[model samples]
Target chain A: MIDLLVISPILVPLLTLIVCLIPRISAKTSDAISLTSAGVLLACVSWLLITVVSHGTLTLRAGGWAPPFGIVLVADTLSALMLWISAFVAFVVLIYGVRSGPDALSPGHLHVLIHGLIHGLMLGVNGSFLTGDLFNLYVWFEVMLISSFILMVREGHHSQLPGGLTYVLLNLLASALFLSGAGLIYGKLGTLNLADMAAKLGALQDPDLVNTSGALIFVAFAAKAALFPFHFWLPASYHRAAPAISALFAGLLTKVGVYALLRLFTLVFTPANGFSTTLILYLSMATMILGVLGAVAQYHIRRLLAFHIISQIGYMTAGLALGGELALTAVIFYVLHHIAVKSTLFLVGGVLEARTGSPDIRHHGGFYQSSPLLALCFLIPAFSLGGIPPLSGFWAKLNLLQAGIETGRWLFIATALIVGILTLFSMIKIWNESFWKAPASDHPRPATNTGGRPFLAMLSLCGLTLVFSLGGAFVFRLAQRAAGELADPSGYLDAVLKGGTL
Target chain B: MNSLLLRIAARYLSWPLLVVSLWLLYRGHNLPGGGFIGGLLAASAFMLYELSGYGRPQRGFFSISPFFFMPVGLGVAVLSALPGLLGGAFMKGLWLPGFELPLLGKVHLGTPLLFDIGVYLTVIGFILLLADTLNDESS
Candidate 1:
C-alpha cells in the first residue's frame, strides 16, 4: 500500500496525460480531467508527506529488483515536501488555466493537447522528486524538458520561436553535460543508484574523478536553476509563454533544479568536498547580485518577476553553501515561500496584462483606484517577496540570515542583506509605477474584469503566503525535520539499500 | 516519384514489412526486438507506400488519424502495470502458463508483451503524426 502511494504521484499524472490525449476530447473535458488529476496528486502528495513524517523515509524498488540493480523511488521529508508544494501550485495553476478559458492561452484544438502536456510535466516533476537512481533522474529531466518545450511553442506565434529555440538549445546542452557526467560516474563506481554511489564514493581512493564528474553534474543543474552565467535562458524565454504557463514555470521548473542541487549536494556530494562548495558559494553570490540588478532594469512585469526568480535562487544556493542543519532548513523554507510568492506575482502580472493589454509597467497606473482587490493581492506577495516583517518571505530570509550569521559567513550575510534591499527596491518599483502612479495620460485602460478565476488563483496563492507567515512555526518545524533528514543520508541510504518496509 | 514500378514494389512490400514488424514485437519480450524498433519498422512501411505517390494511405484501416492511436496506446501501456501493482510492485511482470502453438511451439504470454504492444502503437502514432506535420509544412 505504501509502495503504491509512493508511485501514485507519478501514476496519477501519467493516467491523466493519456486520458487528455484522446483525439476528440473537448477542451472542457480535458480541463476537468486535468484539474481532477492535479487535485488527486495534491492529496496523494499530502498523504505521502504524512506517511513520511510518521514513518521516516519510504522506498519502492521498481519491479522488486534488489538495490544497486534496478530503479528505486525514495521519498524522505524533503522529497515529500517538494512534491506537496508543487502539487498544490500545479492544482491552483490548472484552476487559473481552466477559468481563464482555453482560447486565452492556446489556439483552437491545441487546448486539450496543452493539458496533456501539463500532466506530462507533472509526471516528470513527480518522477524527479521520487527517483532514487541517477539515470532515472536524467530521464525525468528529459520528460520535463520535452513537455515544457511543446508547451512553450504550441501557440506557434512567431514571437515565441526565438525564445523557444534558445530555451531548447541551452537545455539540450545542459542535458548533454548531465548525461556525460552520469556516464562518467557509472564508469567509475559501476553503479548509477544514488544510495549505492554515495556508499561507494567514500571508499574510492581517487577523489579527483568523482569531483570532476560532480562538477559537471553541478554545472548542469546550475544551468537548469539559472545560476549566474547560465541564468540568461530564464528571463529570455519565461515571459514569452502564456501567463498561466509562465506562472507554472516560475513556480515549479527552476525549483526542480534547486531540489536536485540540494538533494545531490547533500546526499551524494557532501559539502565536505571543497570544489563544489567553494564553487557554489561564489556563483551563488554573483547570481544574487546580478539577478536583482537585472530585475531592477526591467519595465515588463513578468520579465521583472522572471529575473527575481533567478535572484531568489541565489538565496537557496546560499543556504546550500552554508551547509548545516539550520541552513538546509532555511533553504527548504525559502523555497516553499519563494515558489508561492513568485508564482502569485507572475499570475498578478498576467491579470494586469489581461486588463491593460500591456506588460509594460510604464503605461500602467491607477490600479489602486480601479481594482483595489487586485492591488491587495499583488501587495501581499510583493511585500512577502521583499521580506517584509510578518510575511512568509521575511521569515524565510530571517532564517537564512540567521543560518549565515551562525556560520560566520560575513561576506555572504552582507551580500544577502544588500540584495534583500535591492529586491525590495524592485518590488517597490513595480508597485509605485503600476499601482500608485496615476494612469498614463495617453494609454487607454481596457475594461476591468477583475473578479474572475485569475483573481481566485492569485488570491489563493496569497492565502498560502499568509498561511506560511501565520503558521511559520509549524512549517518551520517541518522544514527542520526535513533538513535534519537531508543533513544525514544514513536513513535514506539504509532505506534504499536495505529496502524500507514495502 | 509516381513511377508505376515503384508503386508496385511498395504495394507488394508494405504488408510484408508490417507483418515482420509484428513478429519483431512479439519476439521482443525475451529477444532482441521490442516495441520501439517494431513500431519504427511498421511506420517506415507506411512511409514507403506514401512515398510511392499515394498521399497518406486514406482508405480502410489507415483512414483513421494516427493521432487516435496515442491515447489508446498509452492506456494499454498503463493498464499493463495494473497486474503488477495489484500483485505488489509496479511493472513487475506476471507471466501466464505457456501454451503450445502450431508454428511457434510453446509461447509464454505476459504483461510485458502488452506493454510492448502499447509502445508499438504509441510509437506508430507519434512518427506518423510527425510525418503528417512535415507533409503539412511542405505543402
Candidate 2:
C-alpha cells in the first residue's frame, strides 16, 4: 500500500495525460479529469509526507531489483515536502485555469491539449523530485521541457514565436550540457544511481573529475533556475505565455532546478570540494541584485513579476550556498513559501490584466476603489513577498538571514538585505500604479462581481499564505527535519541500497 | 512518382512487411527485435503504400486516424503496470503459465508483451502523425 503511494504522484498524472489525450473528450470532461487527478495527487502526496515523517526515507526499487542496479524512487522528508507543496499549487492553478474561462491566448479546441500538457508537466516535476538516479532526472527534465514548450507556443501568435524560440533553444542548450555532465559522471563513477554515485564519489582519489562534472551540471541547473548570467530566457519567455501557464512555470519550474542543486550539492558534491559552493555563493548575490534591478525597470506587470521570480530565486540559492543544517532548512522553507507567494502574485496579475485589458500598469488605476477584495488579495502576497514581518516570506528570509549572519558572510548578507528592499520598491510601484492611483479617463473600472471560482482560487492561495504565516514555526520545524535529512544523506543511501522495507 | 511498377510492388510488399513486423514484436521477449523497431517497420510499410499514389491509404488496417491510437496505446501501457503492482513492484513482468502451440511448441504470455504492444501502437501513431503532417505540407 505504501509502495503504491510513493509512485502515485507520477502514476496519477500519467493516467490523466492518457485520459486527456482521448479523442472527442469535451473540454469540460478534460477539465474534470485533470482537476480530479490533481486532487488525488495532492491527497497521495500528503499521505506520503506523513509516511516519510514516520518512516524516515522511503525507497521503491522498480521491478524489485536491488539498487546500484535498478531504478529507484526515494522519497525523503525533503522530496515529500516539495511534492506536497507542488501538488497543492498545481491543484489550485488548475482550478484557477478552469474558472478563469477559456484561455485568451489559445482557442477552445486547445483547452484539452493544454490540460494534457499540464499533466505532462506535473509528471515531469514529480518524477524529478522522486527519482533516485541522475539519468532519470535528465529524462524527466526532457518531459517537462517538451510540455512547457508546447504550452508556451500552442497559440502560435507571431509575438510569441521569438520568446518561444529563445526559451526552447536555451533550454536545449541546457539539456545538452546536462547530458554531457551526466555522461562525465557516469564515465568516472560508473553508475548513475544517485546513492551509488554518492558512495563512490567520497572514495575517489582525485576530486577534479567530480568537481568538473559538478560545475557543468551546476551551470546547467543555474540556467534552469534563472541564476544571474543564464536568467535571460526567463524574463524573455515567462510573461509571453498564458497567464495560468506563467503562474505554473513561476511556481514549479525553477524550483525543480533548485531542488536538483540542493540534492546534488548536498549529497554528491559536498562543500569540502570547494568549487560549487563558492561559485553558487557569488553567483547568487549577483542574481539577486541584477534581478531586482531588472524588475525595477519593467512597466509590464507580468514581466516585472517574472523578474521578481529571478530575484527571489537568488535567496533560495543563497541559503543553499550558506551550507549548514539551518541554511538548508531556510532553503526548503523559502522554496515552499515562494512557490505559493509568487504564483499567487502572478494569478493576481492575471486577474488584473483580465480586468484592465492590459498587462501594463501605466494604463491601469482605481482597483482599490472598485474592488477592495482583489486589492486585499494582491496585498497579502505582495507584502509577504516583500518580506513583511509575521508573513511566510518574512520567516523564510529571516531563517536565511540568520544562517548568513551565523556564517559571517557579511557581504552576502548585505546583498540579500539590499535586494529585499528593492523587491519592496518594485511591489510598491505596482501597488501605486495599479491600485492606489486615480482612475484615468480611459481606464475601465474592474467588474465588481469577484465572487465566483476565480476569486475562490485567489482566496484559497491567500488563505494558504496566511496559514504559512500563522504556521511558520510548525513549517520551519518541518523544514529543519528535512534539512537534517539532506545534510546527512546516509539515511537516504541506506534506504535505497539496503532495500528499505515499507 | 505514380509508376505502375512501384505501385504493384507496394501492393505486394506491404502485407508481408506488416506480418514480419508482428513477428519481430513477438520475438522481442528473448531476442533483439522489439516494439520500437517493429513499429518503425510497420509504419514504413504504410508509408510505402501512401507513396505509391495511395494518398493516405484509407481502407482495412489504415482506416482510422493514426492519432486515435496514442491514448489507447498509453492506456494499455499504464494498465500493464497494474498487474505488477498487484503482485509486488511496478513494471515487474508477470507471466501466464506457458501453453503449447501447434507449431511453436510452447508460448509464454506476460504483461511485458502487453507493454511492448502498447509501445508498438504509440510509435506507429507518432510516426504516422508526423508523416501526415508532412504530407499536408507538401500538398
Candidate 3:
C-alpha cells in the first residue's frame, strides 16, 4: 500500500487538470482545484519520503507483472528526496499563480492551461525519478519536455515563439540523441530495465560500446541541463516565459537533467572509469565559470538568474566529479539549496516586476525604503546564493571544497573558488542595481500594497531556504544518507531484481 | 473556394470511415491497429468534413469546441487505469470473462480497451482542435 503512495503525487495533479478541463469550469474554481491538488501532492510526497526511509527502497511492478518485462517504479532515498522537494516547490508556485491571477496564469483557459502544464511537469519529473527502466526514463523526459515547451510558449507572446522555437529544436535534438543511445544500449544488452542493465553491464565487460553510449547519453543530459556550449537556449528562452513559469523552470526543470546525470553516472557508469570522470570534471569547471560570467554581463534580472542556474549546476556536477561520499553529499545538498534559493529569487523578481512594470533592473529602484519585506527576502537568498556564511550555499560550497581537497584536485578547487567569487560579484551586481541604488529618475513610485499572495509564496520559499541554513545539521545528514544510497546501487538492485523473483 | 465535390463525397463517406475506425480500434488489442491509428482515421474523417464545409457557419456537432476532446479524453484515459487500482497495481490489466453477444458472438472487456478508447477520443479531439485552429486563423 505504501508503494502505491509513489504514484499519488503524479496522479493528483493529473486528476486536478482533468477536473479543471471540464467545460465552463470557472477560473476561480479551476484555481481552487489546482491549489488543493498541489497541497495534496505535497502531502503525498511527504508520506512517500517517510515510507522510503522506514522501508529502505520501495518498488512497484505496474500491472503486477514482474520486472525485466513489466514497467517498474522504484523509490529509494534519492527519488523520495526529489519528489519531496518538487512537490513543495509545485505547491508554492501554484499559490503564487493563484495570487497573481489571470495575468500570471496567462493565455486563454487560464487555470486549465496552467494546471495542465503543472500536471504534465509533475508526471514527467516524478516518473523520471521513480522509473527503474531506462526507456521509461526517456518517455518521462519527453513528457516533461512537451509540457514545459507548452508552458514556455503559453502566452503566445511575440518574442516567446522564437525563444520557444530555440528551446524546442535543441531539446528535441537532445531527445533524439538520448533515444539513439537507448536504442544502442537495448541493442547491446537486450534489456531496458535499469537494474538488469547494471547486472548485465557489470558482467559483459565491453568498454567501447559502454563508453560510446555513455558519452551520447551524457551529451543529451548536458543539453537538457544546459551545460556550457549547449546552454545558449536556456537564457534566450527562460527569460521569455511568464515570471511564475520562469520560477518553476528555474526551480525544477534543469534539475531533472542534473538528477538524470547523477543517477546514470552513479548507477550505470562507474566513476572509477577514466574518460567519463575527467570529462565530467572539466565540463563542470567550464560550466561554473562560463555560467557566472554570463550572469555578470546580464542586465535583465531573470536572464541573470537563468545563467546562475547553469553555473550552480556546474557545482553539483563538479561534486560528482570529485567522486566520494562527501562530494556526492555536497551535490545533493547544493541541489536542494539551489532549488529553493533560485526559485525564491525568481519569485522576488516576479513581485518586483508586478510592482514595477519591468524586469529590467535599470528601470527599478527604491525597494530599500518602500518594500522592506521584499528587500529582506531578496537579500537573504541573494547572499545565500553568493555562498555567504551560515546560509545554505556556504555549507554546500564548503563541503564541495573539502571534497576537492580530499580528492587532490587542486586545479578544479581553484576553479570552484574563482567561480564562487565571480558568483558573489554577480549577486552584488543584482543587489546594487535592483535594491541598493537610488530609484531611476523615471521609475514609478513604489506601491504600498503589492498583494499578500505573491509575497506569501516568496516568503515561504525563502523560509524553506532559511530552514536549510538554520537546520543545516539535519539536512546535511539526510543528504549524507542519500549520497550513501546513491554511491552504492546494490540496495536498489536487490529491491528491483529480487522483488521480480518473487 | 469550398469544394463541392469534397463536400458531397465527405457527407456520404464520413459514417463508413467512423465505422472502419471502430473496427480498427476493436482489433487493436492484439493486432497492429490500435487507438492511435483508429483515432487518426476518425480525425481524418472529421478533417474531410471541415474541408467540405469551409466558410459555412459551424453548426450542430461541428460547433462544439475541438479543445473539448483533449481534456475529456485525457481524463477518461487516466480514469481507465483506476480499475486497475482495484485489481492491485496502477496499470494492471483486468479482463471480464468472455460472453456471447446476440449478434456479435463473443465479447470481452478490459481496462486496456477503455484506455484505448480514451486515447482514441484524445487523438481525434487533438486533430480536430488543430484543424479548427488552422481553419480559424486562415479565415
What is each predicted model's overall lDDT from 0 to 1?
0.89, 0.88, 0.85
lDDT of 1 by residue, A338-392 (tens): 9999999988898888778888999998989978998999999999999999999
Summarize candidate 3's per-residue lDDT along A1-502 as a digit string, tens digits: 6545867866887777667666777767777888888888889999989888877888888887887998888888889999899888888988888735323586456657777777778889888988888899999999889999999998788999998999999999999999988889889999889888888888876777778888889999999999987988999999888888888899999999999988888877664332257888899889999999999998899999999999999999889878879999999999999999999998888777777778898888887887789898899899999999999999999999999999999998899899899999988887788788888888664544557788788899989999999999998988998899888788888999888222
Fraction of true interface contacts that also occur in model 2: 0.68
For candidate 3, what is the DockQ? 0.60
Q: Of models 2 and 3, which has the larger lDDT?
A: 2
For candidate 3, give the lDDT of residue A416.
88
**lDDT score for residue A335 of model 2:** 95
- DockQ, every prediction: 0.77, 0.76, 0.60
Please list the residue runs of candidate 3 whose C-alpha ends up more than 4 Å from where it truly belongs after superposition: A99-103, A107-111, A272-275, A445-449, A500-502, B1-5, B52-65
RMSD of each: 1.5, 1.6, 2.2
Tens-digit lDDT string for candidate 2 (B47-125) = 8777776587667676557768788888888888878888888878899999999866789899999998898888888
TM-score of each: 0.98, 0.97, 0.95
lDDT measured at residue A158 in model 3 versus the true structure, 0 to 100: 93
| Clashing residue pairs, backbone N/CA/C < 3 A, model 3 | A63-B92
